[model samples]
Target: MRATVIGAGLAGCEAAWQLAERGVSVTLCEMKPKKYSPAHSYEGFAELICSNSLKASRLESAAGLLKHEMELLGSLLVRVAKENAVEAGGALAVDRKGFSDGVTREILGHPLITVVYDEITEIPEGEVVIATGPLTSDSFAQQIKKLCSSEYLSFYDAAAPIVSFESIDRERVFFAARYGRGDDDYINCPMDKAEYEAFHEALVSAESAPLHEFDQQLKVYEGCMPVEVLAKRGQDAIRYGPLKPVGLTDPRTGRRPWAVVQLRKENRAGTLYNLVGFQTNLKFPEQKRVFSMIPGLEHADFQRYGVMHRNTFLDSPRLLEQDMSLKKDSHIYFAGQITGTEGYMESAAGGILAGINLARKLRGQAPLILPADTMTGALVGYITDETVKDFQPMGSNMGILPPLSERVRDKKKRYGMLAQRAMDSLKAYLQEQGL
Candidate 1:
């Protein structure tokens, strides 16, 4: 059998790989160089348009467990990501360019995969996967809307700024991770009350970039909320939100700082680091002026300024089946952020299942519907649950999984047990299905 997977993003690449490996001919389509999304610039597949880090990588964490599950299912992205991994303390960070280039090589090298470069304005016939992503082109988005007969819900998401490590004042910063989790993997810029107050004042007053016509009436996603927008909520809002100094003592002061700004490694070379929780839509000059107020970043060289863009997702609960196929048409499947599975890895996992289920159906085999207790399964369940009203995008988290019979109060121990249960359930289910 043959399949057409549109949009050679993380989801489309994952989906195309799964089908090809399972003895299906795949046509993977991408629209780059010809057209670019507001956030995308790289002319490569599986581009890391946002942060380079893929959240925490410890098996006890939700993101880590979900990745382990994907590895079990022969995830192409996960394998390539680890090979291109950068030092991110307890998280999995990759050199963005290296990771995307690696993925492009793998997908293009696959014997059963054929790549096509064009904008798909209309849905294809027969077996098809729509992984067009959140910043889908207007022409194609309208086609999707007509296909589902449901209005797409959207929210604004922002990217943080990256500063050159050499430009950061070493005298003003200390290297340490939160609660000493990593081996001094982060550069912490401590702030006294006076400094923090001044920064907050400037951030709230900074001029933001004007929104596009489609982006008016802005609704921001809490996960990627611009630091400036969050600051306007109240004076101490950011202190509790992004600048919280709950852990780590400043060696210079011998006490916890009033607030702190963290810079995380953006590549393996450690030449660049992104301001943690500093996503913004401020004017370029305003960003430089306001952000420089931070102690270590007084003269920081910005490699890339912060930007905000419109992100659109379907009301998946009302329109998609558990396998990520349209309720009205089983031949068409949706993946990625467009299907309401948010975050980088979550989108890839959705694609894995959509491809597996579609390929299996063609072979007259049972669909591999994961157990609800698994992180991947729970995420799919949330998106497809018919009762979910006012649907929003969701990412991997321990809270979404089925609760354990035994209550463990300690947060770490509780998460550990939960992770263990999820893994066992996924393994057992896969074994039963002979996968």
Candidate 2:
């Protein structure tokens, strides 16, 4: 049997690899060299277009648990990410160029997989998986719009600005996590009440970059809200959101400051740090002017300014099944950010499920629907749950997973048990399937 997988992104590559590995001939379609999306540049498959970090790697964390589940399902991108990893404290950060090149090599070298470098303006006949990412081309996006009856949904994602670590005033900053949860994996810039007030006012008053016609309709997701838009909600709105000072104390003042700005390590060298939860669309000059108000960032050199972009997703709850196949069309399946699963690994996991399920279908095997206790299952469950109201893209979080049968009190121990249960369940399924 043959499969056509469009868009050789992280999701597309994962889907194509999984199918090809299962003795299926596959065509991995990509438009990188022939045409590029606004967010893409590299002429390779599975490019990391956003932040290089794949989030925290501890099993007790939501992202880490999801990744563990993906590994059990044989995810190609996650495996390659670890191979090209660089330290970002507790998170898995990869050398972007190297990771992309590695994924491209494997996908191209596969005997069953054929790389097709062309733009697909319309969905093809026969078994197909559309893993095209949020930045899908306008022509194909129109086709998707027609197929889904104009329910092609959207949300805005804004990236945080990166600043040079050397430019920061170390004397004014301290290294510590909130209540020292893990090792000192973050750089904290403290703010007094007076300083916070000044910063808050400047932020809400800052000028923003103009949006494109498509982006003008973008509704900001709470998870990635622009700092300026968040600040204007109220005077202390940002204080409770990104800049909250809870569980942290300023060594300089020997007490918790009114608020704080965190800079997370952007790469292994620690030369760059991204402004944590500081997504914004301010003009480049405005970002420099306003963000410099923080004590430690007085001379901060911004490596990249935050910018807003449009992300297109489907109303999956009403359109897709647990196996990620469209309910109305058995031969068509969907995956990635376009299917309403957010984050890098979350999208890749969807691809894994789609590819595996498609292969199983061709072999006349039953569909694999994961239980809600697992992170991967819970995310898929959420996107495909028909009872959901006003569906929105969801990233893996501990809250989504079903509660353990035996309630454990300590947050860390409880999460650890939850992670173990998911692993055990998925392992049992794999073993039963003789996989």
Candidate 3:
């Protein structure tokens, strides 16, 4: 069987790879180098426009378990991510360009995968997976809207600013991971009470770039809320959120500061670092002026300013099945952020399921509907749960997984048990299905 996969982002690449791996010829479509989205500038496939971190790499953590599950399911992107990973303490951070280049090579080199450079203006007939990302092009987005026959729910998502490593004032900042987690992989800017208050005032009062008229009624996703919008919530709100100083003591002060701003490595070379949890829609000048107030960034050179953009996703509960295929049309599948499975890995997982189930269907085999206990299955279940009323995009989290039969008092212990159970369940299911 032949399959068409649109958009060569993480999800599209995974979907096309999986389909090709299962003996299906794939026509992978990408508009990049021919066209560009407002947020995407990289000519390579699977570009990481936002923060490069793929969250934590520990199995007990939500992201870790989800990635582990994907690895088990033969995820191509996950494999490439590890090969190009940068030091992120416990998280799986990758060099964006290197990772994208790696994925582009693999996909283009695949024997059964044929690359087509074009902006897909319409949903193609036959088996297809729409993995176009959240910032899908206008004409193609319209095609998706027509296909689903539903209004798209959109929210404003933001990316944090990146700064040069040499620009950071090392005298004012200290290198340390939270609680000494990794190898002191983070550059922390400590703030005293007076400094934090001053920063907070500037952040909340900073002028934001004007949004388009249609985007005036902004619905910010909680996961990627702009720092400025978050600061407006209250004075101490940022301290508790991104700028929290729960861990680490400043070597100069010998005490934990009132607040801290963390800069995580953006690439393997450690030349560029992004403001951790500093997603913002602030005007470029405002961002520079306000962010410079941080102890370590007084002379920081901004490599890239933070930006907010409209991210569109489908109401999957009403439109999609557990297999990520459209409920109205089984042959048509949806994957990635467009299907409302938020995070990078979550979207890739969606693609894996879509590809696997579609391949199985073609071979006249039963679809693999994983149990809810597993992270991937739970995420898939949540997106397709028709009982949901107000559906929003969801990323992988332990809360979404089915609870343990017996609750453990310790959070770490409980998470470990949950991860083990998920792994065991997935193994058994795959074995039973002969997959």
Superposition-based RMSD of candidate 1 using all C-alpha atoms, in angstroms = 12.1
lDDT of each: 0.87, 0.86, 0.86
Error of 3 at 185 (Å): 44
Off by over 4 Å in 3: 154-309
Report the error of model 3 at residue 364, Å: 1.3
Pairs with backbone N, CA or C atoms under 3 Å apart (clashes), candidate 3: none
Candidate 1: segments with Cα more than 4 A from true spot: 154-309
RMSD of each: 12.1, 11.2, 12.4
Which residue pairs show collisions in model 1?
none
lDDT tens digits by residue: candidate 3, 157-224 = 67788786766889999999888787998899999999999999988888999875555677776978
Q: Give the per-residue lDDT of model 1 (tens digit) for 201-288.
A: 9999999998875567677778889999889999999899889988879999899999999888754445457888998999999999
Best-fitting candidate, scored by lDDT: 1
If both were scored by lDDT, which would come out higher, candidate 1 or candidate 3? 1
